[model samples]
Target: MNYTLNQLRIFLKVVQNQSVTKASEELHLTQPAVSIQLKNFQDQFEIPLTEVVGRKIYVTDFGKEIAEAAEQILQQVSTIDYKTLAYKGQLFGKIKISVVSTGKYVMPYFLADFLKMHPGVELEMDVTNKNKVVKSLQNNEVDFALVSILPEKMKVEKIDLMQNKLFLVGNMEEDFTKKKKIEAILENRPLLFRESGSGTRQTMERFIVQQDLKINKRMELTSNEAVKQAILAGLGYSIMPLIGIRREIQNKDLQIIPLKGLPIKTNWSLIWVKGKNHNPAALAYLDYLKKEKEAIIHSKFSWYEMM
Candidate 1:
């Protein structure tokens, strides 16, 4: 069967999503445009690539096999294109990363200077919980991942970009600056928690166990933003990454509570699977980080160091 690269891409996306509408949304193509390409690609193959029943699309077994082949072919083509750019002495290609939600605040600052330097390079970043971030790395779906807490099971290499500090935070109505016993501070203040599978939640769990503290669990939230809003509403207190709450602290909307062992420390690390062969753009970005990360942290995140 003869088919173009674009057709292969569209067909692969369709097969992956099992819906033309979802594929079009992800690819930034109109539904009709994706449908046209999918139909054209299907016409090239003698075997039926898809079957639709009751307005739902399903890829045939043969289509599943074809989609795997298409993925490999696309990867090869992308490598060749990237190598061509390198041969022309231009740093050009895509770098995809998956980051934990709280890491979003830090990841972009580290990327800005590098991206500015390599204008031809493109970036794709997905921010989600720690579970999804690690899953992306395990599946080889991204070049790297950013997390404050490393996965225990994955054999990976990492560059420690900067320190991540977690502190007890709440609305400024209470005098949280005075040093107080952990239990006293926690009394009557319900603990707002991130949903399970979050790196921040895992850290809080570890701290709770270490301190042998009992928490009045009030709400389980999915995102940092949700937890922040809950705290600002005076619904509860939460342990949050200082990086994500810098603006709130600066604006005096929130304050850090003083307690023994209050700020839990971890490094924000850029990690990748141990033996995966990264493409040129990814390798260049890694090298850039190794050389410039410390300088960037010194200039940008010096406030965390002072705390």
Candidate 2:
């Protein structure tokens, strides 16, 4: 009945990880400290929050529900803290965005200037796969989502940022110039794929379907960086975002093989729930993007088209 917010945080981390060691590591505390706090928290409730079996920890059903509630509680408390601090700065609080993995390369450049201008503003950007990005947006866990492919059922307002182009990318070892045929390039070389729900993978699938081609998915990676590494090692070719691989192309480590009906293009967009009320920082961020997007693109991303 007298558990502190710190206890709640410890308990939540323990439940999320189902491992006291991992929770301790993430909390930057010792295992004994995490265990002590978790035990203190659990003592306040009648039912068991977690159980240890065969030296492994497992969160009980009640623990899962309580963890969810704790997350909401912590989120609200954070909002309150930020709100209290807002009076100190011109435009203060947090700007939270969940972005598709490739978006990591793009979003930060746009945000750097804005953050510098508003010294008190804080940025929380989550770089994840498309599925997690969409889920976070749908759950209202983030103020905005940066994506190329919009979610199907969400009534979201989108601010188009710029073009996102996907090209068949390979290590320099591949002889792309000699064989431009879709079938020839796709033939012997296995295709490295991003896991399902990646925007690039979806785009690649659509391209395959449209061309009536089949790819041998010999290697699959969950992140753009990992895919790039696999390609650099000559594992296989992959359809990759030009933004994520521009440096590699420039360095001649990777080559973009232009093919007929290639370069699946889409617009990177900042999207949010159509009617959701945005906080002051979020609103200011949207306005900044609206006003400075063109200049930012010209100055920061002019090479996108050239690459």
Candidate 3:
């Protein structure tokens, strides 16, 4: 009950790093000082927050819950500061965004421009799989998420930012230059699939089912880079977003497999939970996205045709 914000911050740091020593280093506090505050924080709570085993600290289930709460509190405090600055006509605050792995290709340009225009704004970006990004958005852990596949369960306010072209790609050495029918490709070639729960994989599966096509799953990879590498090594062909493989295609390392109904069109969307009150920074960035999306896409990715 007597824990201060500083104490909670130290606790959060410890939870994040899983080491008091590391937390102390990052916090610029002596190890003993960090231990004392951690003890004070734990003493205020009836339940144990963390346990030490083999010289490593691990957060308990209750600790995890508390960490989430602490993060919310910290974010709220940060928002208060942001709001105060906004009242004075200053654009400043931290914006946390999570994007699917493929979005990494394009999202950075937007962030870079935003940061340049609003020099006071701080940005934190998490690049992860679509499932984790969705979870972060659902939990209110991020201000916005960039993704192609929207979750059916969550009530989200989204805008179509751009088109994501999904293409069947293979190694340049493969004889995919010749146009082939979807049915023949699926029947003859081994198909590389993204790991389950990926937005890319989900879209590809839906397309396969809609077209009544069957595939032989040759291998499953977790990341786009991994899947691309597998394809480059002649492991198998995969359906991937054009954003992630543009350079490879340009370099002649990979080639698109022309098939009927290929290049599935999906929208890249900027989304946040419906009814969530966005901070000024988030609102400003959203406005920027709305106003500059076309220019942003064209300026950064002019080489690729916008579908």
Candidate 4:
């Protein structure tokens, strides 16, 4: 079977957009051309590549897997293209990155520094939750993902960058310092919990279950901001990353209570799909991150005590 790089690119684009029309617009190709290319790609395979549901197109599970392979292939081709251009002593391209929501807080600053180092390179970022981060990596939607929890079976490389400590926060009026474990303080208080699939929430739940404590999950929030607001309003207590609530903790609007017998630490990692190709921009960005990882970690943690 024979396939062109352009056809693989069109297939990947359609899967990413979930719409042939959108892929056409992005690729500046006619809708008919997009459809034809997709058809050609499907014909090459033993099975259909996509199925239409109403007006929208959905790539089959197997098709999605093939698209991932195509993405890696395209990435390798792009790497070669970049190297050809690099022979002239110039680097210019885009490096796409995705990060879990919590990572957004610090990733931008590091990215800014990376930009300063390589002015010709452009950076694109997508912020979402842990599950989405993993999905994005698997789909090759982004070159790298910064996240706290690494999934179990993915063929990816993870570099442990920093440790984010989980803290229990309550209204300033409540003093849980006398209480050792989170179970004790939460006995009579309402607990605000982040939604499922959240790294912070997962960490908190694992801690609670490991301690054999019964937690009353009175409320659920989708974001750290909402949880902070709920806790500050005295509606409930919450467990969050210390960095996430640094300001409130320092302003005396919220109090951080230590937990005993609780594993309240999470390791943040910079991850990329294993064996996938990397362009100059991607490599440069990764190098910049590794070089500044220590300084970045130091600066972020230094302010935790103040807050």
Candidate 5:
């Protein structure tokens, strides 16, 4: 019914080391003190946590669950400390950023550059799928998200970083330009698709529907890298941002088919929960992105034709 923070800390240490004696060593407490804390923790709860299996102490399933929660609880306490320090003009705290997987290609380079410019700032980057990134942003687990898509009707501020031309891609071995129209190449060939919830997928889907094309029949892969590999393997063609496939196109490994009115151009945005207190570092990053968007894109894929 009652628990102490020391008990929680000791329980976490035991879980971390998976040995009471090792936990005692780590906590600078005696083995008996560590055992007592574990016992007290179990007594406060309805279930027992530690059991001796042969020569080692192990946790039950219930204990494992509690240990997991304890980790989060301790993490929150650390966050509070960081927040207090930040509030007191300590501009050297960590900022967690969750970005869509595709953004990994560009976001990390930019972040590294930023950190070099401001060595006092710490960054924690989580590259994830679109849905998970969105969920993390919504939960405030991340300071900001560098994403390609914004949910409709969400209270988020989007900064239009840049507009990119989505291209129809085929292998360089194929004469894509020979085809007068994009529809001519669309018949029976397998069309590669990005995983669901991808902004690129949504853009492609909307373009398909607008053109009255059928959505059935295709392979859906998770990452842009996978899609690129599929395309390189001649699995099928996909509509992808030019930034993603510039090297392949230049190396003469891939060819572009120009559709008179195909590949609906879209913008990438930097987003955060609106009306929430954002870290000053986050705001500074946003401004940096806006001010240097064109330069960044140009430097990365200098040869790619932009629309």
Candidate 6:
């Protein structure tokens, strides 16, 4: 009860990151200072907030509840700060965004421009799989989420940012002199796939089912980078987003396999929970995205035409 907002902020960060070291680095405070503040915060309650196991910090059930309360308090504070700045005809606050792994290719470009225009704003981005990204959104842990597929069960508002195409890709050195049907291709070459619960994997599965195709799954990789590497090493072919593999395709390390019903087109979207009150910074960024997203996408990813 006697703790300060700074202490709550530190506790929130520690809980979110599950590491005092990482929280200290993010808060720009000395490790000892962070430890002291956390200890102070914990002392206010009789129940232990967290426990250490194998060098990792794990929050208790009580800690999780406290962390959620702290998050709401921090968000309210940030909203108040943003509103004050807006009233003064200035913009300042933090923007927290979560993105699926494939979106990492283009989200940074958009963020760079936004940061340049509003130098007072701080940004935090979490890049992870679609499942985790959606979980973050469901928990209101981030201001926005960038993804190719929208969740069916969540009531949300979204805008299309750009075109996202999933193409069949393989090593250029692989001999495919003879054109083959989808069935033959699947049977002849092992298919590299993203791990379960990935947006890309879900899309690929739907496509396979719709086409009445069966896959010879060679391996399941956790990240797009890993799948790309596997394909580059001639391990197998994979259906990957064009945005993630533009560099490899340009360098001739990989080539798009042109087949019937190829290049499944989907839109990259910016989404936020419906009816949630967003801070001024989030609202401003949403407006900026609506007005400039097309131009930004065109200028940054014009290479999509080459694919």
| Candidate 3 vs candidate 4, TM-score winner | 3
Candidate 4 collision pairs: none
List where candidate 4 sits over 4 angstroms from the true fold.
1-88, 305-307
Q: Which ten residues in a row have the lowest lDDT in candidate 3?
A: 180-189
Model 5 steric clash pairs: none
Candidate 6 on 221-251: residue-level lDDT in tens? 9999999998888888888898888778789
Candidate 6 error regions (>4 Å): 1-88
Q: Relative to the true structure, how large is the alpha-carbon lDDT of every model?
A: 0.91, 0.87, 0.87, 0.81, 0.78, 0.88
Q: Comparing candidate 2 with candidate 6, which one achieves the higher lDDT?
A: 6
**lDDT by residue (tens digit), candidate 2, 34-63:** 988988898989999999999999899998
Indicate the residue-level lDDT of 286 in model 5: 71
What candidate 1 gets wrong by more than 4 Å, as runs, is: 1-84
Residue pairs with backbone overlap in model 3: none
Summarize candidate 4's per-residue lDDT along 1-307 as a digit string, tens digits.
8899999999999999999999999889999999998898899988888899898788898998999999999989877876776776777799888888888776776777778766667677888888888898999888889888888798888677777777777888765657666666767777888888988888888877877878764788998889988888888887788767767767888887766653377777889999989987898778877788889767756775343
What is the C-alpha local distance difference test score of candidate 2?
Answer: 0.87
Q: What is the TM-score of each predicted model, taking all chains together?
A: 0.76, 0.75, 0.75, 0.69, 0.69, 0.75
In lDDT terms, which candidate is top? 1
lDDT tens readout by residue for model 1, 78-174: 8787778788888998899999999999999999999998876889999999999999999999999999999998899999998899999989888
RMSD of each: 4.3, 4.5, 5.7, 8.2, 8.1, 4.9
How many clashes in each structure?
A: 0, 0, 0, 0, 0, 0
